[model samples]
Target: ASITERFEPAISWDQVARLREIWKGAMVTKGPLGAQDVVRAVELGCDGVYLSNHGGRQLDQVAHPLDLLVAARRAVGRKTTILLDSGIRCGADVAIALACGADYCLVGRPYLYGLAAAGQAGVEFVIGMIAEELGRTLQLLGLAGVADLKAAGEGVVRYGGSPASRPGDTGDFGVLQ
Candidate 1:
């Protein structure tokens, strides 16, 4: 069959409900860009909601997952798992996601690039690089570990641009050094 003929433009919530009914394993709904959708997925029995913009390849100028993450977390509370992806190119990005409220981050492109360059070894190298960078980022933030990120919450990162008047604003709440 042709791609157009096979592709379904929309998947109804009823379909997701049916899937939840039959699938015993954890069910995660991907590509939710708004808090409402994230909450909706949880209400529909999805084990987790994956926040992504498909690398913005599917649609131009879509909201980045990071932009929506905080609100999603607030809407769903801490109990429902929230997985984040898209524009996550570095360990600091993972830390930022976790600080903002993601329980897990899906790193796709870097590992794929590694695989393409040197198969399994390349993939391992990329993973190691990311982990090392994350450790460095945590250290710089004065955090003891990943759990500290959760404890600090959004305080670990500065949102918007740092205030010019403050000049080295580490003392301020939510301002990163």
Candidate 2:
């Protein structure tokens, strides 16, 4: 049989509920683009919700997970675990995600690229590089560590153009002053 003929594209809420009942391990639902869907997933007994846009590969203009993350976190509160993927290229991205309320961030393509380039060593190198970048970012932000980054919350990130106080300031876009 051809791939399309054998593949089932639809999965209903009932199926998800059933899977939750049968599966004793942690269950996380991926691809939630808004707070409502995040709340719905939690209502359905999901242990976590993974916010992603599939790296913008699935759709032309899907909402970015980072854009939706703050509201999702507000809707779900702090108890339920929230995982974010898509567009996480560096450790600074991870810090931003955590500050915005993701409990954990998932990195895919970078490590995969490393794996393809030079096996385990490449993956290690990429991870180390990311870690070093994150460390530097934290230092620049006057933060001690990841715990401090999470504790700092959204205050650490400033979006869009620079403020009037420092006109023509062309510093980093996301890092707050």
Candidate 3:
């Protein structure tokens, strides 16, 4: 699809399951979409939807996760969870995701970096680092577990909302989109 096309290129709802892919290098590229893909996901009794573009890595010049978040939420409504993960790098990303009606967020690159650095140990270290940071953050803000956060994550500030909203952007097509 062109960068200018949002939903204009949409296919029918029944054809997405049979969607085809185009291979490039070692990558598998998706053909296109059908609305029933979303509806089918709903009919299959999903609790939520994930509106991520693999951190923009799956396809070049594709929209980022945040850019797709609002529309996805509007499609799924409040009954389902709308989780996001693509380029989230810090606590601020998590905060914005929650604020924008996302039920959950995941950090892909950070853990991957940890994994690259030291395998399982690197992953554990990253988790420990996050735990330590959260502890310090909670202590400074007088907050408890994540469930204890209010409008924001206590001491953490918003990263000025999602990263995709900025001007002069192409698209992020790396880190699994």
lDDT of each: 0.82, 0.81, 0.53
Q: Compared with the true structure, what per-residue lDDT tens digits does model 1 show for residues 1-177?
A: 877699888888899999999998999999886888888899999989988888878754877887788889889998899988887777887887888889999899999999999999999999999999889999998889999988888656764422211445544433344
TM-score of each: 0.86, 0.85, 0.56
Model 3 lDDT tens row, 1-177: 676575555554344333322222221112212223444566544444566667767664765666555555556666666667777765545555554556777778888899999999998888777667655554555556555653442123323324323353334321111
- lDDT per residue (tens digit) for residues 39-145 in model 2: 98889899999988888887549877887888888898987899998888987787778877889998989999999999999999999988898888888889999
Instruction: Output the worst ten-in-a-row residue range by lDDT, candidate 1.
Output: 159-168
Angstrom error of the Cα, residue 95, model 2: value is 1.4
Q: List where candidate 2 sits over 4 angstroms from the true fold.
A: 1-6, 160-176
Better of 2 and 3 by TM-score: 2
Q: Which is superior by TM-score, 1 or 2? A: 1
Ranking by TM-score: 1, 2, 3
